[model samples]
Target chain A: MTTTRIHSTRTPAFVEFQASPGHRRPVAAPSNVDVAVIGHSGQVGSALLARLDRTTEAPELPGLQLREGINRSRHLLVGDGSVNQQDRNPGTLSGLGARLLAGGRPAVIVDCTADATLPRHYPEWLRAGIGVVTPNKHGFSGDPELYRSIMQAARKGRAPLNYSATVGAGLPVIDTLKRLRRAGVKPAAITAAVSGTLSHVFTRLSAGQPLSEAVADARHRGFTEPDPLEDLSGRDVARKLVIMLREAGLSQVRVELEPVVPDAWAAALPGQVDTIEALREKDAGWREKIVEAQRDERVWTYLARFDGRTARVGPVEVSRDSAFAGLAGSGNRISIESAEGEAIDIHGPGAGVDVTATAVLADLVDAAFLLTRKG
Target chain B: MTTTRIHSTRTPAFVEFQASPGHRRPVAAPSNVDVAVIGHSGQVGSALLARLDRTTEAPELPGLQLREGINRSRHLLVGDGSVNQQDRNPGTLSGLGARLLAGGRPAVIVDCTADATLPRHYPEWLRAGIGVVTPNKHGFSGDPELYRSIMQAARKGRAPLNYSATVGAGLPVIDTLKRLRRAGVKPAAITAAVSGTLSHVFTRLSAGQPLSEAVADARHRGFTEPDPLEDLSGRDVARKLVIMLREAGLSQVRVELEPVVPDAWAAALPGQVDTIEALREKDAGWREKIVEAQRDERVWTYLARFDGRTARVGPVEVSRDSAFAGLAGSGNRISIESAEGEAIDIHGPGAGVDVTATAVLADLVDAAFLLTRKG
Candidate 1:
């Protein structure tokens, strides 16, 4: 019954209602939708809007209230604008505000904010029968009990809760895993390179580039976080691994990430090390190390191994012929090995504004389909 | 609905039910099982019996019969005893024939028979609500329409139709494909080395052994079919490929296997040429050919490719570093490329009496669970 509320700077943002007696409301007839994009500045939020706009065959619904820092909209409008600019709109939702029941109408909340600290309001959303589509992995991976609670709420609410974008970007990993579970095949182990940023960095390092150059290359290619060092540090990959593990039913497992943060960055000023040249100066020795590994027939790989009961995260030296060694670019690959069957290896693009957005869009489509079925 | 009935034996073995004029006898509740074992004399059949015996945890309903060939049996029991073995107690429905449904009890017809001709009875068994479990790939793969008919009957009658052993032995290829489909994934392509016998033969050939020696070694290791030519001819792999394709929703495709039977066996008497010696004779000349291919850093692989609309079967030379080239032993491997996501690879054991029987048992357990759920 714990309800978490996230605030926007534009208008009063309401806390999701728990499934309690006073919160019960009559089901409303299906009608056009009015949606609010929470964390519109984030990747997933933008994607959801694009997907809704492209659906020409669908019945025209009331459009979204473009809110950035606050919620103040009295009416919905059809248009696109930057989140920062929309923050100045007079009708944006800002702090704790009035609860509006999405009812039986096509009202949706697309949470695309990457802020890990934001309180996940899955229960509240589910109780109100409002569909939720998110690219955020945190909700499911954070606490096992809460994850199950969210699923239970969705079932009770008869609403869709989709998080496909939380796993393999557009690779369909979550859907695939769900299918396997439904078919009674238990996953025995999961080995993955779930971060495009990490994979690209590894690919560059394996090619004998220093860690700094790899980070710069990833940034130039738009494959890494704005601060490239954040990816090299392994937090991004760790979060993805946690999400995958939770989906596989290992809810309580904690992934211990061995931070291989470049040593040079430790001695530099935080702001100074944010740039590519500063990062390069810190880990220049990685070039020789990578060359040595190549001479010995080993390739550098960022790996996440999830054996049913536990999970581990680290960088390993793999043979060139191994599956992990062959993964290239900003691709993400996941291999699920089962006790009774052959391993299933799924590979594809893992990170990008477009790819991540596409994944979120896919989740939205799934939710929309579920809602249609419910009706 | 147009229904195709495929029968293995030329003589149709059927039991007719007399319909009361203008009256339907209250459909008798199934109280006993009159089963038919199509390939009772084969290894797969023997292993299936072993699996049935282990299912003692759940007592099997009585009135069970096992029939092979054209003979009718009131009670068909296969064991190492006298052919006329009978139980001292005459149970209800004891005199029933091979018609699985007339036994007045839940019936299970296990077709461990590998005879391609026997697939005709699949629809008949399905219509009668008699669950059919088979290691034979022929029924589902023979005609695409038959696959649809079988699935429809299974759903309509709420009967189980499983043939996991048909493609990957104990590996869960069929099950995985079913799960993938249920999750809304449209498979675009399937690439696999599905024949264990062929994989072993090729592996030995790659190791510089004579063709005859490789065949002999395969037979000695129980890797090849009794008739080594069956494996060499590529029919086994073709059947497996067809089954996989059918499972992925291509119910109309039929594979016309190209005969790759070794030319040396064309004129030789069946028992005259020992495999090892035959391979030795063929090896002397083929050695240079294999050596030349290896010199170019190529490895030979027998591959089956299915691209939704069309399927091709052939052996091709691939780079040693390719995924298929690294496959070892008699492993069965399948790669699925789908429109909804990237490619997925599944690989493991393809054939063995124990493994094949295990697959059948797994299907049985699945059916039991489903039946329990329905109840």
Candidate 2:
């Protein structure tokens, strides 16, 4: 009988296996992924699934099959005659099971869940060589160390991990940064108006609308978070900036976030009034504040900067004709300034299911190519 | 005695070597080059040579000793002791013997020349595993097949070729593009207000100066080409756009140059007058044409685009607040519309010997790294 003792170190499980005797492993098998949706029930998730279902197969990957677990009870299996959808949770495959099926097996995982904790699974899935497409910003921006770890795992495992949907929904800020880096240009700074919800509210306020009315209008347009305050408080912009900063190689830098909470929110119990009602109660005062800004010819913009240190800033007033000015609707604008030279600006829609889904799909295609090439 | 037969094909010479018994020969001794400038003697060349001479050890290869033929001459050697005041015939290796001796060995080449034909020597040098750094735009922008051939030769020969000075004199556009590509985002389009000379003229014209006066002012400031028409005609910007396009994989396509030549020079003899004098000689109608553009509140900009197809435009009117608007002095502005659905805009100093030389040095560092890594 052989007894194998494992040492506890920070190294990966596979690396630790070096001490085991005579464990020859087979080369990873090539995989052909047909479909992958990370957040099965969310807005972006459903949109991606529908798009995949509608796409006609091409020669890039032959005999592609959407591998839903037999335990997925709610997913309706389409195109191919296979196992019953009512029998299992198609999107809930265990790490080992995902690896077994997606390892050397072509597969994609499209993550739409906003749950910050979901990204912890990225490294495991990537190590098993599964392509990950996500709209979750938390994985890439929440912590720089972990973000790099995930990237390293993807590289070591020869998998693709794409997250274009993380910032600016459908806009390609991440991709733009990657290209700039590839071309050998380092960004000096990034000035981005990245929150669709925030942009909408700011626009309404600039036009003399009360902050509460603007918040309500943003909600009607599906631009605001459920609590409304999430957008108004500047956290959304801060999160997006952090993601950009990480890509810019500034990791773990503290991001200073100043609450842009309405005046009434300061007086009300944090949990008692939803952000929408608080802003509504302070409508008169907020209107006056906005009017005063306009009288001074200033444009209100939520700006962030990653200036070689921590990402910093909050809602600030910029002069007209400045890059940050004139943004409307749910637009996202990003300007990157690097040690190399002047800033590079990127702007487009920051939210929208279709655009976000398209971005995710683009990432999936990129991942598919990466995996296939590695094989 | 063995009979030897050498056969040639359309492919590069080094690629055709045979290892068969009768044809096999031992590889030659590797050549140590401290620098390998692609286009070695033009405006940028003179400054580059001066910079290298002042900074590096005469001409010593990184670690190799100076061999007799290799270091016999210092002044005549490429990138040796100093920029020679006298001009030699284009093809001859003039004071190479003295130059080679002054410098321990030629470790690097500062390519200030912009000739397309210069790249023909790259494959041979690369096969010899020499390192090359250049500001020449042609090597990266010319024919795609040729560019690929050069890249393949460099890869197989384990050589390093760097050309950061190809796109934005010293702005780091190429470096940025490379990073973006590496990060998994492909550029969709590239737009730029990219000429110091053109920008100066445009600004002058916008300020109500006559076209002729603007051209003269540009010349006085050393921003115009020796034949200012080249700058005025938008050919320079076209070349830059071609470089960016090729980097983005549109290598096979030729950039269609839409001549934006001033009306006064449209039918003039090539050598009839300096661009400034030629514009001055224009009929009163030309001045009227200039005033008309300004009346409409438009600014003239030399613009180039790679919208899936290579195209160049400008010295035409573009409205204020557009991407090309508001470029000051000799600054360069480049807007890259990436496949990731966003546009990246970069602006900075477009011309200066020191800046361009710095860019060339950056490329040299990059080449050094590539060579070391391959080794």
Candidate 3:
């Protein structure tokens, strides 16, 4: 037992644990949950698999069966480590529901893929009563029609489709929004720093590091995507803003994305080496902007805002005393300003494999609980 | 329709609210929830009753049947406004479970009382398979034995026991702690400004107001207890700290509170007028401390901290740039620093009747959903 010790403020007192189950995870007869991983080899997916497969004295989630792993080319049986003959079926979410239902238990598809095409299958899978849990942003933040369809399908089938990891990694961003919407408290405006990579880059720039070094550092520390252009182009932040806006009742708001790097600059630096060299060459321009911001006692921040309908995301100069200026490292900060003039701020690390995977597992557990009770 | 209009950032677009249900509340056949409000005439309870009874065009919580209202003197049937013959039963939580069970639907008890003895009924009520939702702090932050029994009974009966409003009103404090614990992330330290009344008082003090004036102002604004001594004595903050520390897995940690006002001064004031006058007479002492804080460029904040096991709460001098110093009005701010040194901060109002009622309703809805599904 790894117990945290502290200096006693009073006499040594031991409070007995009543041999009770911890909160949330009820100590009921074990309900088997058959789970399929769509992006099985990805960072979050693999971490989730490892957590599910590892057995411990005190099990957090018991009876979770890793039925199959479905990647692009193959479908592998998790128990036997053998490649299944049935590959990705073009229809019916690659037969994910069928495979999981074969286990005679609650079925769930864990999508960790960041690709756009996977989300198209979410509605069909959810409508089939197979729960969907993911850190995937493409489904909720992409096409409005798809987002609407996914929500409708989940409701129609009475299945749990949780995408809390889509916004601020493991932070309770989406859950907060859903609660507010449920109570009919619509947000008048939402100001957010949703991209951890961009947050890091801006924090470094504020600390006098050049843009090229900041981008390099972020990528080296695994904060940015494999292609850093995805983060640098501000699409990631835009996507998160879209998700929040949709969650806040503006389902089809236009997000005018103002990228940190210009389209011409992004187009100019296609290759990795060329991108680094080009960014290094453009250091002088960034230096001027940084100096200007410092002179005004302001910090440069990539901000995303949605006020009722107009949604825009880009870099902006904010006061030194502002909350946005206080953010550091790979942290994400979202401030929801409700129509009633109440504001709630949530801050945490917005990107990481462990945290994101844990979020997916939390959602999976909720779905499994619902499945068990409904069954 | 009270629609908020915004200038079109693009072409005017109407994203149809598809013929689908909202995110959380399923559009299936209505699940009737028979609710009995226990302190139904109290501030939070009355607000909750109003919200539950109001028939808006767009019903936020549908199929909710307000069965009975249990106040100090009477048990009134909410539907027809008739008093029931059965008063306080002195046993079985005043027969709350029996009355709601008679409805032949999902039964729930919403405890909005602050008395200490109401918590003793929690274990028995939960063990009987009736769900509980409360904003009451007494049941959670009081005796360790009762806390253990309540949790054990909840798990044993598979009942949903939610107290999210206990610590931070409606700021998602307990929910965040539960999520982190579920993911196996143990918080190393929890630093919080959990008292909205004290937060307002200190904010005023920092802005050059005397302690006496600040307390009076807070009371005038309906932020403090009817008896200001409860807020001034610091016991409320201590109870909140205890609840938070237990939620962070230190279920039996002792909280040593340093009151904002000394015992000598507190005992000297017997009435409301005497309290205000005594506080005014002690203005010189508070002014000295305020001036000293200003000289050091610090802000006076009532902060609660739980470092592993040693829980302590009181007033502290924090730098102006710190998060605690930034809390304004009646907001609560809680920062959970994980063992790995990652910190997540949640900030919002810590005291309000409407928000607290909403928090209780959210929990009630969740409990009702679970019951509906289980049935």
Best by lDDT: 3
lDDT digits (tens) for residues A58-115 of candidate 1: 2211223332222222223333453233333443432212233513345556677775
Q: Which lDDT tens digits does candidate 2 get at residues A263-291?
A: 34454557666666766766876566666
> lDDT of candidate 1?
0.57
Interface RMSD of each: 26.4, 29.5, 8.0
Give Cα distance to truth, residue A61, candidate 1, Å.
Answer: 25
Candidate 2 lDDT over residue span B44-138, tens digit each? 65555555433222111122221211111222332333434333344333333234335544344444666668676666666556656677767
Residue B163's lDDT within candidate 1 is 81
lDDT per model vs. reference = 0.57, 0.56, 0.74
The candidate that achieves the highest TM-score relative to the unseen native structure: 3
**Runs off by more than 4 Å, candidate 3:** A1-29, A53-63, A73-76, A80-93, A204-214, A264-273, A278-297, B1-27, B53-62, B80-93, B204-213, B262-273, B277-299
In the order shown, the candidates' DockQ scores are 0.04, 0.04, 0.22
Docking verdict class for candidate 3: incorrect
lDDT of 3 by residue, B1-375 (tens): 112122222212222222112344445655677888889888988998877743222232346677877778766675555555456545535667776667677778889899789889888878877889898888777776777789878766667888988988778788777666555566788888888889889889888889989999998988888788889777787778777766665654677777777756577666546677678876777778778877877777887877766767777777776768756677888888777778788887777887788778767776876776565
